[model samples]
Target: MIRLRAHHLLCLLTYVGRGYTPAFVAQYSAIVARLNAGEGAVLVEGPDDICAPMLDSGHHCREPRITTRDALAREAVAAALGQSLAPGDTIPLDGPTIARLRENFAAGTIRAACAACQWDGLCSGIAASGFSRTRLSGAPV
Candidate 1:
């Protein structure tokens, strides 16, 4: 099933097919299978390496792949996903959800999630640059 941390899913929105190993693409296929099923995807806020296989794709640039078991992290992730997700909520990682995220990101609604991200500076730069870039390195977009 396609399960992921909120930020990882966020990263996928801008994925332009770079930096991933072939194996990761296979894994991604499976994830997509679930996401396409509307209710087969899972979202979490703690201790799950949902994005591990694809983190090296550079879309995320070492930003956290798993949310931490903390109130702030959970809250931020929930804000990002636009739902009150717990550690194992079945969510739809489909177009509408992702589209909402994209709009929210452009409109500054997902800043809370960015607050919990290590890539905050890079994300800020992306936002500042009017989202001219999505695949960023840790070096400030």
Candidate 2:
């Protein structure tokens, strides 16, 4: 199973093979490929698979602001999925679920955690474009 922080669940929706560094993007792309291939994901508290590459570089995965973003993402995602999402909880990445999240994201209902994120504009543009050209696949059209 892929281990991911709460905020990453939102990030995956608009991922288009870009990240902080080449290694980070490589790792994230691999993770997205796994998810697209039907892999499952478990919610984690801090640095997860995606953060592995950046961990050795003194990344800010443990910062208070980042943690706060995770908390907000957890709450928003939990509400969106109508399920309690805590650390160690399994998240379903099915097409329907992804579509639902994308819909909410586009409508701005599940974007509270994105307010302070650097990729907010990019993600917003992706959502506005109906998630076209995103790396993720297998969702119903």
TM-score of each: 0.53, 0.95
Give lDDT tens digits, candidate 2, residues 1-141: 999999999999999988999999999999998888888889999888999999888888988888998999999999998989999998888788998899888998889989878899999999989999898773233
State how far residue 53 of model 2 sits from its true place (Å): 0.7
Model 1 deviation from the true structure expressed as Cα RMSD, one decimal place:
7.9
Mark the regions of model 1 whose C-alpha exceeds 4 Å error after superposition: 20-22, 37-39, 45-77, 80-82, 112-141
Winning candidate number (lDDT): 2
Question: Pairing residues by index, what is the TM-score of model 1?
Answer: 0.53
Off by over 4 Å in 2: 138-141
Clashing pairs in 2: none
lDDT for position 38 in model 2:
87
Instruction: Give one clash count per candidate, in the order shown.
Output: 0, 0
